[model samples]
Target: MTARRDELAAFLRAARERVRPEDVGLPALGRRRTPGLRRQEVAELAAVSIDWYVRLEQGRVGTPGSAVLDGIAAALLLSPAERVHLHLIARGEAPPQPHVPAPLSGSLRALLNGMPLLPAYVMDFRFDILACNAAASALFGPEFGHGRLSNTARMLFLEPEARETNLDWAAFSREMVGNLRVNQARHPDDPHLAELIAELRAASAEFAAWWDDQHVHERSRGTKRFRHATAGTLTVAYDMLAALDGSDQRLFVLTLADEPSERALRTLVTAHATALANAV
Candidate 1:
């Protein structure tokens, strides 16, 4: 515990030293002995007492709450990843993960549209749909639109239609749960993810049971079966491509592997287009 506190204090000091006063809109005071912002300045930015900040910096303070940590992070101008690390070190627990979606580049959108025959979509770290091509919208239905309804994990677990849409419901649910577990382990402090897991556990008994198994899996590329409302059963091969940007976004493309599946996909896409045109 003492060692942990020492490490936390040192980390806080280093983070404070890296931040400049001008960066946080503070005037540059002439001739400071230290390179970075002073402890008092950091405390003021965080809206905490100087003594309290001093105790925290000297390894005399106990684990702070989320609000205090958040303030410190802001004071230090910590990046998302750094903020998470700070919480872990100080509290020995994961902090809340904010939902800051990275922007989708036009090139990625063009790439998705380029594959007219395939159903492709982009997902953030939380499996939230960021963007999708026309084929994906056709395949997954209109609920696949961006927003709460489009979250892949939420749709799979909470949405009643998923049980009917996924042909192999048991296998598919297990794989999705396992993949989520892997991500949870990778980023335990993410608040949004924790909330998602809690919601799933409360909503689905099957999800709760699967989560208990502590299974971890990373689903990059594989074969998945779906029962389309109009097109019927189809088996497709999928490939998950990682984005070059450091946003932890992945692009998933599903291609029809067989003639029957190809026919179904084409029919689905055509019907979707017709319905959209009629609606417009």
Candidate 2:
């Protein structure tokens, strides 16, 4: 518990130091001794007394209420996941409205396989490919066949084939980094996710740059173009539908967006079916 309190204090100091006066629409009155906002400024922004804020940062205060923590989170310009993390570390409990990532069930896999025409699959907040259908395999190639990439961020940022497969590869790569940032905040204790992130940061220069920008985004619905070896160029619209059972899983569906793409995908699917039949 003492260690936890120390961590909470350290986190608050770092978060406060990450902000600037102009960032929060505050006037730069004088030169600061630190890199970020002062303790008094943060308290003023959070509507707390300077004395109390100082005490909290010093680990001298008890667990703060949700409303007060929320105020501090806003004052610090924390992302949603960061806010959740703050609550967890500060209170030593699951954050409010916690999202726990559950493994995909058989029924969920069945649902993915049911989408024979559209490429569909389920991924957790960690961007791990849990279950993908045949059409998804036909689209993304063997990466989906291997379940999740050893590291999805590495694939997006380091794999040359991925750049060719995703037409707007650079944009998608940055978006993936942002998505991972959000997930890392949500599941701070997930060691696998942490390892994957560390590997990505060390391996991919693009990933490191985007991560340092402090931008977070989750791409829910978008159109992407893929240049398939067999199918030529196919344009598809994708959607992510969250699981109704309150799990941290989302069904990713990709549908042909135009007549040309539909024809190409149909031809590709037929060839894939014939190959599977021959193999058996």
What Cα-based lDDT does every candidate model obtain?
0.80, 0.76
What RMSD, rounded to one decimal, does every model reach?
13.6, 9.8
lDDT of 1 at 77: 72
Tens-place lDDT digits, model 1, residues 179-275: 8888776655555565566556545678867887778878888887888767888998888898988888899999887999999899888988899
lDDT of 2 at 217: 90
195-233: candidate 2 lDDT, tens digit per residue: 466445545667757877887998788888888887788
Give TM per candidate. Answer: 0.65, 0.63
Task: Estimate the overall C-alpha local distance difference test score of candidate 2.
Answer: 0.76
Off by over 4 Å in 2: 1-101, 147-151
Model 2 clash pairs are none
Top candidate (lDDT): 1
